[model samples]
Structure formats: structure tokens, C-alpha cells
Target: MRAVSLVPSLSEAVARTAPGVLVGVTDWCTHPAALDAVRVGGTKNPRVELIASLAPDLVIANEEENRAPDLQALRAAGAEVLVTEVRDVPQAFRELARVLDACGVRARPRWLDEAEETWAALPVPDDRLRAVVPIWRRPWMVLGRDTFAGDVLARLGVTPVHADHPDRYPRVPLEELRECGAELVVLPDEPYRFTADDGPEAFPGLPCALVSGRHLTWYGPSLGEAPRVLGRALRAARR
Candidate 1:
């Protein structure tokens, strides 16, 4: 079965679970370090015609990471597309299984099982810290409402300040974010690449936890270690 993955996490999941199945992937699908699939541009602006030319049996994508028009175009070009929606950990696991199954994988991948077990074994936090999670600077877009990253952090005892916002990802002023009464600022290393030197400085006195974006945001194999890695980072930042 020839498959093309537009979402990075799904790409890694498929690559690890069923090697040699993915014929094309987006430029941002960087896991496995040595993935040998054809580059199909970025997720948002994937080369649809180029992808269609590959004549893959199936194309994988996400509701948030990929554009609707692109998926429509793929279908119009006679390509089968499977789109996934993952808002929380449970949904992520379910969707992962669904995508793999669609790719003709009968046996559930060991990593998927490990990730489920790891999350299930995590003890719920007694105290949750309120935080503002910035996915990007400049325009200052933050994690708001229902989001996979926000849910992941919530599991690790960090609650996003804008989780109740009307928009999923809202653009807020830096000053507003600073004054949101959040005790912590959670920054991930992707979509913005927030670092110890770069992002924490903007939050002033608030504790800034620089977490791995892949572990925090991506819902593939990284989910297995997200609890420990994010918990450790949050603990250190609060110290």
C-alpha cells in the first residue's frame, strides 16, 4: 500500500509501524531523521499536483494541520485521503489506530500500545498551574479552546489560560498574555522554536517551561514520553 502523509506525527507513526509504505511526506515530517519519502512541500501548502502524480493508494492528513481545499483537490484527482481529528490523548490514540488500520496495518504497533499504557499509568495531578502557552510570537498566537497541545499539558498539570477562549488559536497581545494572571508560561520548540534564551525572557517573573514541541504537540510515538518529559520541564521551571 502506497501512502503519503501530510501530518508530521502521522508520517512518523506510519513510517515506524509499516516501513516502506509512505511514498511521500511533507517537508516538516522530520522524524526518523532518515525518512526517504518524496518531499511534498509543507503541510499548509503541499504540492497537490505533485502528490497526485505519485498516485498513492492513500493520503493521510489532519483537520488542523492540512487545508480542506487541498484534500478536496486530492480526492478530485482520484486520490484517496484519510483525515484525522485529534483533540485529546484518547482521541489521538483512537485516530492513530484508525490511520494505521487504513494503511492496512493489522497488528497494532507496539509504540502505540506503549503510549496508551504510559498515559494510563500517569497519576492525575492534585494541583494544576495556570499557564499561557504561546505557539508563535510576533503576532502572538496562543493555544486557546480545545487543542491537542492544551490537553497534553493539562494532563501534565499545566492548564492553558486561554483554554476557554472562543477561538482555538487566538492572537493576543504580549502585554495581555503577561497580565493574564497565569503562574507559568509554557513554550514549545516548534511553530515558534522558543528557547531558554529567547522565550523565557519575554515572560518576566513568570516561570517558563521550555518543553519539547514534538512531545507536547505531536500525538504519535512521542506521546509515550510526553508525561515524564513535560512534567520534568514544568517542575524545573517552577523551581
Candidate 2:
């Protein structure tokens, strides 16, 4: 069946759904690597006319990633639209399942299983591990409570300075870092690769360090080896 997907994560899901049937995908959708077969529409603002002309069986979209109008247009044009929301691992798994269901892909995806075990088995240090996860800087955003980033840190027994609230990535004031009750500042590499040089200089008095954003953050199969990597980092941070 021909399919078009909106985001990278769902693109992976769709590939798992129908191994070689994906015929159209957003520029941002890159997983299964086979999606190279699909014609390109911009990731966010895909050229609807081009995609609709393909006459795909269905289109997949992530609520978090796809712009509303594009999805609505796909639906209006007679494409069956499936919107997925994968904030945490479980949700991600379900979303993958749904996409595979749509694509007639068989069995669960490997990344989901590995990600679950990794989150469950990660060990916490005997003492409280305080940390700050900054996803972006210069109009800084942080990995706060109840997010994939927060879940990852929780696996390591670390607590983010941000409160456990509705906002997963709240743009906080620079001064708030000092008062957040955190000992370590984690700078994620992608989206904004924060380096040692870009360290505590922004907030003068924090124990800040650069971290692998993908390992500690990016959910899905990529999450498999992250715990081990993070464990070593936490231990080294302890040293």
C-alpha cells in the first residue's frame, strides 16, 4: 500500500507497517532508510498537491510534529489520516503499533522493546542525582518533569531542577538555574549543541556539562543503548 508520513518517528512506524509500500514522505521523515523511495514534500509544509497526486492509500501524521492545516488537507483530499502522539515510550509503542496496523506490518518494532527494558532497568545512584537538561539555549528551554527527557533522567535516579508540571520544555529565566536545586547542568547536543565553552558562563555558578542529546533524549530504538551511555556519564560526573 502506498503511504505518506509526516514525521521521522512515524516514518519509522510506517516503514514497519509496510516494508516497501511507503511511496511519499516528508523531507523530515527519515527512518527505515527505505523512505528514500518516497517523493519529497517539505517536512512541515509538505506540498499537498504533489502528495495528494500520488493517491496514497493512507497518510500518517504526528500531532506534535505535523502542522494542523496540512493534516486537515490530507483528510479533505480523501487520504485516511492517522495522527499519532508519542510523548513517552508507551505512547510511542502504541503509535508504532497503530502505524504498522495501518501498513499491515507485522510484529512489534525492536526499538520499542529495547527502550522499555532500558527505562525499566536503569539504576539509580544511592544518593540523589540532581541535574538540569537544557534542550535549547539563547531563549533557553529545559527538560522538565513528565517528558521523555525527564523519564530518561528518572531512570538514572536523577531529578531535574524543573518542577513536575505540565510544561516538559519550559523556557525558563537564566537566573532560575541557580535556584532550581540542581547540581549538574546537562547540555544536549542536537537542536543546539551546547559545548563546554558554552557552559556555566551563561549562569556563572552551576555544575554544567555537555551531554549526548540523542542518547538521553531521542526516544524510539535510539533509546536502546542510551541508558548504558548515561550510566557511564553519571558515574563520571560522580567522579
Candidate 3:
């Protein structure tokens, strides 16, 4: 079955598990580095005309990563859209299974098994650290309540300071975050491209952990390596 993936992680999942199934993907779907699919467009603003012209049997998207109107337009154009809502690791595994099933893949992908095993074998730190994880910087947005990143951090013994906030991705003031009493500052490298030189300066005295946004936020083959990759970064955090 030919498929078009709007989400990067989903693109990687399909490409890695069933190579020839994907006939189209967004320009942002950079995984499998040598992926040869047609680049439709960006996640938010995909070229619907180009996608419909591909005549794909299925299109995969995420509720958070894709816009509703785009999905509606695909449906309106008689395209079958499989929308996934993956809020945590378990949910990601389940959702991936569903997507693979739809793709006619009967065997479970090895990366999925490895990812689940990796997280399962990890020992949660006994001493939890309160951290403020910022995703974007212009207006200063952060990982708030019910997000997959928050759940990943919690399992690793780092609690999001704004986990109870009303919005999942809330835009809190810089000063408000600095004074939030968090023991550490977790910065991911996407959505805003935070670096050791760029993000750490914002939280003067707190230990700053510069993490890979893909591991911290994405759900796919990267999950297998996320625990180890993120753990090392978190452990090497400096004040």
C-alpha cells in the first residue's frame, strides 16, 4: 500500500519497517537519511494538490504535528487519513502497531521492540529533579501538562515544573520560568534550536541539560536510542 507521511517520525517508522510503502513524505521527514520519497511540503502547510496527485492509499499524521483543516481537506479529496494521538511511550507503541497493520505489515518492527526494552530496563532515578523544559524561545513556550515529552522526562526522574499548567504547551514569561524554583533547565534542540551556548545562559544558576529534541519529543525508531541518548545528556548537565 502506498502511503504519504505528514509526520517525520511516522515517515521514519514506515520507511524503516516497510521501505517501499512510502511514496511521499514532507520535506521535514529527514530520517532514513537517504529516503527517496517525493517531498510534498512542510507539516503544517503541505501541498494538498501534490499529495492528492500521488494517489496514495493512506496518509499518516499526528494530532499535534498536523493541522485539522489539512486532514479534513485530504478526507474531502477522498484520501484515507490515519490520525494518531501518541501522548506517551505505550501509546506510541500501540499507535505504531495500528499504523503498521494498516500498511499490511504483519511482523512487529525490531526498533519498536528495542525501544520498549530499552525504556523497560532503565532504572528510574530515586531522587527526582524538578526541571523546566523549554521547546521554543521567541515567546518562550514550554512542555506543560499531558505531553509526551513530559511523560518521557517523568519516567527519567525529571518532573516538569509546569506539568499542572492549563495548557499543554504554555507560553510562560522568561522571568516567570527563571523564578519557578526548578532545580534544572532542560532544553531540546528543535522547535527553537537551543544549544549549549544559546539556552544555558537563560537559566543562570540552574543546571542545564541540552537534549536532542528528536529523542525528547519524537516517537519512532529514535525511541530505541532515546533513553540512552537523553540519559547521558541529562547526567552531563552543568550549572
What's model 2's overall lDDT?
Answer: 0.71
lDDT of 3 by residue, 141-190 (tens): 99999999999999888999999999999999999999999999999999
Q: Quantify all predictions' global Cα lDDT against the true fold.
A: 0.94, 0.71, 0.92
User: Candidate 3 clashing pairs?
Assistant: none
What lDDT tens digits, residue by residue, belong to model 2 across residues 32-144? 66556555576578888888888988887777667899888888888888887766656655666677777876677666676677666655557766787787877888876
lDDT tens digits, residues 68-149, model 1? 9999999999999999999999999999999999999999988999999999988899999999999999999999999999
TM-score of each: 0.98, 0.82, 0.98
Q: Is candidate 2 or candidate 3 better by TM-score?
A: 3
In each prediction, how many residue pairs overlap at the backbone (N, C-alpha, C within less than 3 A)? 0, 0, 0
Which prediction has more favorable lDDT, 1 or 2?
A: 1
- Tell me the lDDT of candidate 3: 0.92
What residue runs in model 2 are displaced by over 4 Å at the alpha carbon?
A: 13-18, 30-35, 39-43, 124-126
* Candidate 2 to native Cα RMSD, angstroms: 2.9
Q: After superposition, how far is residue 122 of candidate 3 from its true place, in Å?
A: 2.2
